[model samples]
Target: MFSDLDEQLASTLRHRAGGDIDPTPIVTRARARGRRLALRRRGLIAGGVAAACVALTSVVLAIPGIRGTDDRVVPATALLLPQAQSGAPVRPGEVGADPATVHFSTDPLVSDAEYATWRSGRGIESVEFRGPSGGSRFALARTEVLLNELQQTLSSAGRPQPRSDVRVGDRPGVAWFDRSGDRQLWFVRWQPAAGLWAQLDTYATSRDEAAGTASRVRFDGAHRCVVPFRLGSLPPGGRLLECSVTFGRSAPGSFIEGALVVGDDSGRWLTVRAQVAPNGSEARRGDLVAGPYRARRQGSDVLEMVVMPCVVEAFRKGWGDGYTEAEGLAILGGYQPAADLDRPDTW
Candidate 1:
């Protein structure tokens, strides 16, 4: 499935790069590939569920067999899954597996050839995504958001923020002290068709704490590393149909919130919350998943609608002082009205 998507992506990139390319063919290929992938994943999940059901049935039947053991001895173990012991108490931390430890960086400019060369030396695998606004300016808007957050954090901590330098991957980027007094470094590089950003931070705490934080950063980085672009240009007569939002706050006072909006024919718009996790995972609670709703025609336009209170609360907690009216509109896919959508002041 990934191979097929990669081919479609390559074809689309060719068209976007102006090599006498047409996108219709690529889009067709991608749609087909996506369908197949989804089906395959669903099948796997179904199979697992079915197996668990069968195992449960076997155990149930075995209970009757145990009563007749004097007449015909039957082993109870034969009727159960390997892990099912009738009298054993389950232990904590033995159910779900321990989370993996990993680290992630947040610099967005690691696409220069020089930076790529450096990363290759460091045994890191990197991939690039091409965007519409030329390679240099692609995702600049999202990067600006990150930069703003970094600046705010630095100022709050009374740390010196340096002028961001464009450097090759091999060279160490900028350095700054974080809110917790950790030293942070950043690097940038360019790739053939995309750019790269790399960041490294070292805390004064123990290795275990640092590793845990790094794991969180890695998860957060994975989510934040992607370039944000409109899925498609807004179609004529398109109207906003629905909006979903989410917000979450970590124990450490970090927070994140996000929203997704859908229009009748305007594709989708996404607004991401700004709290960075060490592992680059999606915000735990402030995630909104919407859609599968019917669109309605409003004159020449189409519309859909969704209202989720839990998701909005997550955003409220995460946005804190940084939230603004304009940002709220973007978060709600440009449809949420000032009066209809609840705000903190109103609450």
Candidate 2:
């Protein structure tokens, strides 16, 4: 789900799409995804009807606390775990939070390092503390689909010390140097927990230094993977599935990349992807969310706009004729973080 898409699809939360992005493949596959999902949704509906028939014959007792799916007013943290709520401890298995809602904080490189620079991401779950002066440059992520592929970026150098096993603190780790670029990029991978893995792209010139940096990655804190924008309501029959944010490299607050997914009862998905624009002017692309144009992408109606440093969109995929342009705009208009696009700390 992570890519240089450096793109923000939920999966796009890893990296924002670049100039070289070829949308042909993704657009092609996405074109058929809706039909496949429609078939699956029908099956689910059929099953529900049978269950409903059974319930009709039973003497139902009143359940005082039963709740409906909609109108549950809660903060965006509705997607987060109790651990992220107030720095409280959660017993193992006590929480089953969505991967999109999970974010982790790492210990500082220096004892006196500030934690504010650590931004949320990797589905916007794992957090990495960025050093301004550049000391502790490490990242930790919860294990998911992207871990192995990311670690495998290193091509087989087939040269001196291509790959080696190392220890991160007490955990077993792998260290490798990617010689694909003009400079060598050191990488290390290890498990912070059973379902969680951590990665470190080290500047260290030696294997020992690389391992040392990775070993420093301690999953010390948790937070909601907060996106720069928010949704006041959801698409009809849709619920939030995931939301991810990516910060700029040169300046953490200078740019923001993000994605949010809302899935409906029909098994269709609505995605809102946001990223900074290449041009300095927002009007270069038009403020789409302001009065979003109902354009189409990959066979579905899409609402896209340019809000200055941010280019935002909400589009449909995976089954059914879903949200109309009006519906999509409601989701997009509710979030107006243009004032804080460069304020990562506020995120």
Candidate 3:
């Protein structure tokens, strides 16, 4: 209890001094923040302008045939069969007028099996046969011109398949055994005629059964290869490889209808095929593959498709650069088959 309040007065003065502090540092920091924000906003606007220019350029370049002069690759139709690209194109036919025809069978080549479907290529034809066991290829040919080619291709040449010399009746032949998982596949090739050869293949069956099936192939028919649709000319230096269709009196819902395979001098191949819509096979729906195909299938090299009630798919079979989807569709435009595609009478 001192008479005068000196300590209290000193405390009060200290508080008043602290309350009246300098505001210069805070003001300076706020000014610096404002400048930074303004710079950032300007950068954002410039970046957006640059991005817009790039997008505009890309959109201009994306049009199909907008390249400089003849730099674009448009779908061109021409007929050049096993000839040089520089050669003059031949006259376009109302249909695939390929002179090369394979020997064909009107009846089932295998006696016990039923003839289901068939396909003909440049110089060859193969028929599909089905029975209680499964399906197989039992092909009979009338001419010998394509026998050597058949032997070479079916034999697989350099990287060869294991084979054995077999005799179907008095006709000497060879057999190839392909092992896939738990099943064994058999292909027996025999000289049915003096100059010509025939093939009998089993999907999966005993070797004895395969040999017996091979001996039963009937070789008495003169059927010619006639195309269903008008061919839209081939690519330069392209040759027809195979033409396919589904045929059967019993099976109402055929698997596939029309296909055309074109090959270049370099051995690259392209296939365009139109198939039945609502096919029972899950494999045949989206991508139309080129194979012996009665079951599951994977896609070819490059595939593109469209739905026209009948599904159409085309693919070039190699990793290298090749034709575009537009080009493939143009090629397929030549393959619209007749309504009675499954009937031999119409074929």
Candidate 4:
């Protein structure tokens, strides 16, 4: 009866047969085809369910603080420094690295030069790292200058209260918080070496962030010396004992003025100082020779120094009787061209 029957015929005969079908190869084949179609439909539905589960899993993983147990937000990229190790444990006195070499974990709020200039006028060499907002400013300064400033700050207001002993990395440090009127200041200081110290100051950031930033600071070496400018040649047996560079603007242009005090074993001292004006033209400040330097006698004992064009010349003369005029002249004559003494690194 089903010899020439198509799918429509098979369906009609199966329905007409009520509850039973004759035991034949054609009926058996038709039943098997129905089962295969049902399996295919179930497979498609299963595939769709599996795809939805995968998509939901992906979304859950992408949501913040949900996919895994770890709650900390891992930074995608870290700020890099030329001489810093990433994610290294830092300790006090472990590395007397220059503050300039310190790399914060976050992007800087200001340029390096601007940070340098900001501290130049304050009589200290410091590198500042700011948080994403205006209220977060952190600074690292040399130990000597930092300590001096701390002492001054404390003494100015009776006696400053100390927070507690703090450690950054392996370095032991101290902390202090000050609130005066409308301003609040927080400070953390640590020693990186026998004679070197590092400081972190925060204005508007949380203490934790400041501490974390301080701990993140690391250097690749034992120490890095970053000077504002390079020195030419010193007088014979003349050892540099003290120096300070100040950054400021002049009518002609930006200028840097500083004093370099040097002394020898003879108990003699020579003070060399010059204010460089960035006029890019010749300038004559006084009656000293005006080629690249001019010298004038302020008094019988003091010699005023000046520079011209773009040459680095020693301009000041405060010498004891032990060192002779010829020696001073020799010290000034060995003037290095402007290449050696560039603007302050911060400038």
Best by lDDT: 2
| Residue runs of model 4 more than 4 Å from their true location after superposition | 1-159, 170-172, 192-197, 202-206, 221-233, 242-261, 265-275, 278-293, 298-302, 309-330, 340-347
Q: Where is model 3 poorest over a 10-residue stretch in terms of lDDT? A: 50-59
The TM-score that candidate 1 achieves is 0.23
lDDT for position 69 in model 2: 19
Query: Residue by residue across 1-347, what tens digits does model 2's lDDT show?
Result: 11212224423522354423334234323322332243236446654211100001111222222111122221211112223544443222312235334434343233322212223322323333223332233444444355543322222242424568989888887887755335455777777666666677644667788788677654554455555666666756767766555422121122235666766667666778765443332444433333333222322355566554455667654211466666776776665553453333345
Candidate with best TM-score: 2
lDDT of each: 0.25, 0.45, 0.43, 0.39
Better of 1 and 2 by TM-score: 2
Over 1-347, each residue of candidate 1 has an lDDT whose tens digit, in order, gives 23224334654666574643334234433433343344346446665211101111122222322221112223322221121222332222221111111112222322211101000101122222111211111111112223233212111244434544333223423434334334332222122112233333333233333323222222122111111112232234433232211111111110112222223333332222211122211233222222221122112211212332112211212112233333333333433322322222111
**How many residue pairs clash per model?**
39, 14, 0, 9
Misplaced by over 4 Å in model 2 are 1-85, 88-102, 106-146, 149-163, 181-183, 249-255, 264-267, 275-302, 306-311, 315-327, 336-347
Ranked candidates (lDDT, high to low)? 2, 3, 4, 1
TM-score of 2: 0.51
User: Model 3, 39-127: lDDT tens per residue?
Assistant: 34544665421110000011111222212111322110000001111222221121123423324332323333322444565545665
Better TM-score candidate (1, 4): 4
Candidate 1, superposed: residue stretches over 4 Å from native: 1-151, 161-171, 178-194, 200-257, 261-347
Better of 1 and 3 by TM-score: 3
lDDT, residue 284, candidate 2 = 46
Worst 10 residues of 1 by lDDT: 113-122
